[model samples]
Target: MGEGNWARVKIILRSPASRLKGVCADARFSGPVGRPAVAPVLCINGPEDKLFRSQSADITLSSEKERIKKMLSEGSICEMNLEVELFALQDSNAKLVAALHEANANVEQWKKQLSAYQEETDRLRDQVADLETHGGHGPSDLLKDELTQSLEELESLLKAKDEEIHILQSKKSEYHELERDRGEAIHRLQELEMRNMDLERRVQNAEQTLASSLEERDRAENEVHRVIDILDVKIFDLNDLRQSLAKLIDK
Candidate 1:
């Protein structure tokens, strides 16, 4: 038996033994109601009464023992199951945390790429303005080609950003599922709930920052397109001027 069980059994045994001793003491102290008692001596009940009471106490004690054993067994099983579940939850939480970290890292990397793209777009815009002020001379075609390439690259980056957003959305869904599973054990594990809430808050913050970054990228892409359109118009006008000059020289 376990220490706890042994302690309980000792209490059970003590109760009956103490009660029996008390009965003997009471019988010895009080004889017939008015008669004076002699020296304190052992008080004995009838053999049949003693036997019957002993048998009854034994039966009660045996039943209690069995009940306690059964409860202990059931409790052990429950504890084992809870341990298994706790292990599983810990493993899953670790994986989720690792994935969340990876996602955050990816977002940070994309943010850096977007910043670089924004800088490139600003430089291209300055180049286009310079070309316009100079009447679109000197390697106009090469600059136009470069601008087209940058535009394509920006569009591809935008597509990649959209894909990253989709991935984040999926991760969010997984988090929701994890939250629901954790909810089942929430009452039993307040500490896990607190940690989960903190993780959720972090994910929300990441999502907001990613959203803002996406907006900025969109604005930069629009500005680039506008600059490209202006360059195209300027190039067409320069082309017409070249054709008109060539016709005058031929005449």
Candidate 2:
């Protein structure tokens, strides 16, 4: 089918033609008694002559048969080898396809997890914003104002002396309690901030993993295409070889 293959067929075809030409030339000049024979039938003069010619013809036919057998045997071996190689390539292609499917499944799973993480991150961000807005002027600010007013009252009460000492002590206890609550609220806010940072880091890692899996899938697909193309060319070559052998046999 290809120009190169056709050329090879032509070369193979010439061998048999050349062999036939040699046989013809031998019949014309190398006849019995060293005399040139115009035709094979004219060369025979007796039963012995006929016997010699028959024997020579039989030898030539036998040799040609053997040569043809040898060529066919070699071609069969080559075909077998090609078949084995084709089977191996097909197996490898199947494995690659399986791996590609597994990679696709993994990619899909990662996508789902990434989506979930993103939704959770968004929710956490919204909560952080709400806490910042409400808590900025909520319990902590109110407690600071109350503590400041209590300190002013205590300073003024200190000048009034012994009667109000007990009252001053009670206000001090309430101020310590409010300070502790503010510390706890700040601690909770810091923990939330830390949790948000960890989630962001996890989201970034998931994205990178997804990207890597996609690239690997692409590479696997390319390899499968390359193997398929190779198999096509090999099949073509095998067909061409079969056609050439058929023509040789016909000749």
Instruction: State candidate 2's TM-score.
Output: 0.37
Off-target runs (Cα >4 Å) in candidate 1 are 1-45, 137-139, 176-180, 183-186, 189-251
Model 1: weakest 10-residue lDDT segment is 35-44
- For candidate 2, give the lDDT: 0.53
Candidate 2 segments exceeding 4 Å error: 1-44, 137-251
Per-residue CA lDDT of candidate 1, range 1-251, in tens? 46776665456436875445434434433432232224332222443344445455556555555655555555556556656776787678779878889989988999899899888988987898897888866547878898879889988998989998898889878877876776666545554445445555555555555455455545554555565555445444444443443354354
TM-score of each: 0.49, 0.37
Error of 1 at 175 (Å): 3.4
lDDT of 2 by residue, 1-251 (tens): 66777777667657876455434444444322232323133221343344454455556555555655555555555556555555555565556556556655755665575566556556655655676698784335644465456555555544544334454456456555545554554555455555556555555555555455455545554555565555445444444454446565565
TM-score of 1: 0.49
lDDT of each: 0.62, 0.53
lDDT for position 146 in model 1: 87
